[model samples]
Target: MSIPYQLILTFISGGIICVIAQLLIDLTRLTPARILVLYVSVGVLIYAVGAFDPMKDIFGAGVTVPLIGFGANIAKGVREAVEKEGLLGALTGGLTASSAGITAALLCGLFASVLFKTKSKRM
Candidate 1:
């Protein structure tokens, strides 16, 4: 059986994103937190320039599942909110657009904490 072309593109795109992150970890002094911020910022910039939709169309979930996607989602939310709610949207839009994701993350963390013992890091 032949592999689907979309699947191949998805794998390759996602892999490239992962590889870039790994390289940053291996070769740079930047902390993981900084790298994450950098990625999200890049995503926001891409969305600002109106490149995100095309990239998402090509990369599918490969683009949408990453931190960059999260940033784009926030930007989208803010834009829509600003259009609908005036200046107040800027303050609430990101959280509103990302609420489901934020809720899931929190619930997952709660479950994990309840289910397993976390080890404290020693400084």
Candidate 2:
């Protein structure tokens, strides 16, 4: 497939996920963190059940491009940990695999917080 097509597919998939998340937030009272965890869990479960492989094969990172991809990384990390460190891998793999993304997000948030000014309330 062309790179453009691949990107389009990935964007659509990611957008759909975002829309679903928004709907859940608007319709219910779930916290953003809970919704995020739910998406990751669903992705892992789908991958575990042998369902997400074909999509992954077709889209490559496109299928794994969203928070779903993060979950997949965790699953992969756990599997690797099991292979290398046995029990320790299970705990470390997920965090290790997703660390880069987490770091980037944190760095961005920190930068925004530093650069942006807020109005102070007068007593």
Candidate 3:
């Protein structure tokens, strides 16, 4: 398709995920942490089943920037690790694969915290 169509698809795909997350937050008792875990778990499942590959081709970062994408990375890491390192790979692969991302996130958070002050929420 064209660039415009791809952009539309990407926006819609990401928007749909956001909408679902918001609805769950508004209409259910589940906490944000649980919802995030659900998204990541679903991502891993979809990745494991090979469903996310085609979607990634179409949605690009729209599909890959979310927690689900993180989960897919974890699954991919474990798979490759298992193939190369035997059973121990199952235990260490996810952490090793995601370590950079986790470190980046921590560094970013630290930088932001240093650059800004937290304000108390006023009810």
16-123: candidate 2 lDDT, tens digit per residue:
778888999989978999998898998877766776778786667766877787887778777788899989887888889888999999999999999998789999
User: Where is the poorest 10-residue window by lDDT in model 2?
Assistant: 57-66
Q: Give the alpha carbon lDDT tens digit for every residue of 1-123 in model 3.
A: 899998898899988888899899999977999999999899889889998888899998788888888998888898889999999999988989889999999999999999999899999
Q: Candidate 1's residue-wise lDDT over 1-123, tens digit each?
A: 134887788889989998899899889877899989999888888898999999898888888898999999999999999999999999999999889998999999999999999789999
Cα lDDT listed for each candidate: 0.90, 0.82, 0.90
RMSD of each: 3.2, 3.8, 1.8
Per-model TM-score, in order, reads 0.88, 0.74, 0.87
The parts of candidate 1 lying over 4 Å away from their true place are 1-3, 119-123
Q: State residue 48's C-alpha deviation in candidate 3, in Å.
A: 1.1
Query: Candidate 3: minimum summed lDDT over ten consecutive residues — where?
Result: 60-69
Candidate 1 colliding pairs: none
